[model samples]
Target: MAADAAPRSLSGKVLDVLDAFSADAPELTLSDISRRTGLSLSTTHRIVRELSEWGALERQGRGPYRIGLRLFEVASLAPRGPQLREVALPYLEDLYEATHENVQLAVREGLELVFLERITGRDAVRVLTRVGGRFSLHATGVGLALLAFAPPEVQEQVLSGSLERWTERTITDQGQLRRMLADVRRTGVAISDRQVTMDALSVAAPVVGPDDCVVAALSLVVHADGASPHTLAPAVRTAARGISRALGSPTARRHPAGARRRASGP
Candidate 1:
């Protein structure tokens, strides 16, 4: 227990403290940071003060601690991270204007789906998703789309076991999920009906890069009542294609109707 309580190195301690903040718990107290990092209060406070001084964490007037702008300034330099968001924002705007629904963009990281962007209307069905949040790859439209085109090893690894069930409609059966992925590959789109939430439905399509590899996905979320997945697919796919074009994908403009490529899109 004593061994487990100690970080192996100074770098590990710094990293553990930095990771204590999350989308769900953006602001944390010193005690919260201590518990999250499994470090003693004195150690946690010492590092927290150092990090705060360096602008990696922020504290205001005895307020809870939150991640600081300096991290964002550094993170902005990542090529495919926020830079991709800048390219996709205009297409996302167009999709939102056309449908007035919840539009989202996401990328696959391991077996988790990380939301990159989201645009929601006043009446969009309520969702638990937030930008920079992560969810499983078997319970969302963007998840299915990215999973469908993911490397075979990643597919097999996720399918092997531990498929989580988010809602009653979420697919936990490996065989069934395999077939759904096949359908996504066949149609160039993915539909998630009440998979994440019973009141919402999502339609998604992939955005491929110039190398003909899928890089991200785009989707639209609407009320499930009287909703049509096929009806929404075209617009969602169109937005995905547009974002791909803005990212300089050669196949974006050249994609044929019902393209047979892995990432046919719109």
Candidate 2:
């Protein structure tokens, strides 16, 4: 069967085929690919052949196909992904060693938080989050921090949308969420208590850019029991500042009091 009058060009069709593969469905058989892409079997096969030949997709042991290693190599060139991860890894490792928890780095892509990196300690709380995965802008601590610093229009959009509830503690009320965002702006951090998951809590801080604008957020998720968001705030803020400094932001200086004391002492 042919597709509807959607005016699908050759390039569009090829992109459609490629878009069929997602994190959930990383590998797909030919029929699965055709069904997911909404293309005919022959069209899917032809485009898949071309993509596979060009090293954009790869076939596995006589069955499914997945995104090729070449795509990953090319994606590594993306400044916001691998480049940011490379710069932030050492600090993230330090944070993990200090807390023995799940450390995450994320950036806003539209209204969603796209996790760029996640470092998990052996005994840390088990989280469903994955690197390169996306989550709601209102659920996670990093998401809240990013959303708090987002443009007014973006804030309005999120507020107007359906605030999906993930747990009993999830803040779905627009007014409450707004106030929480205000607090994040004032405190330079965000704390999510059992919001995304019942057993987890997260603390997050904003990462500023050269323009002193919040470009991303860094966070630590740990078990809720006996954990205090206030205690974790300083560590999250420190890591965020480190990443901001690496990003060439002048506002990335040490804590204000420490800087003042150092200047006064010398």
User: Which candidate comes out best when scored by TM-score?
Assistant: 2
Query: How displaced is residue 70 in candidate 2, in Å?
Result: 0.7
Candidate 1 weakest ten by summed lDDT: 1-10
Name the regions of candidate 2 deviating beyond 4 angstroms.
Answer: 253-266
List runs of model 1 lying over 4 Å from the truth. 1-7, 256-266
lDDT of 2 by residue, 1-266 (tens): 22665779989888888888899899999999888878889989899999999888998679799999888888899888888888889889988988999999999999898999999989999887889898999989999999999999999999999999999999999999999999999998999999989999999998887788988899999999999999898888888888888887876654431143356443
The Cα error of candidate 2 at residue 18, in Å, is 1.8
lDDT of each: 0.88, 0.88
The superposed Cα distance between candidate 1 and the true structure at residue 71, in angstroms, equals 1.4
Displacement of the residue 131 alpha carbon in candidate 1, Å? 0.3
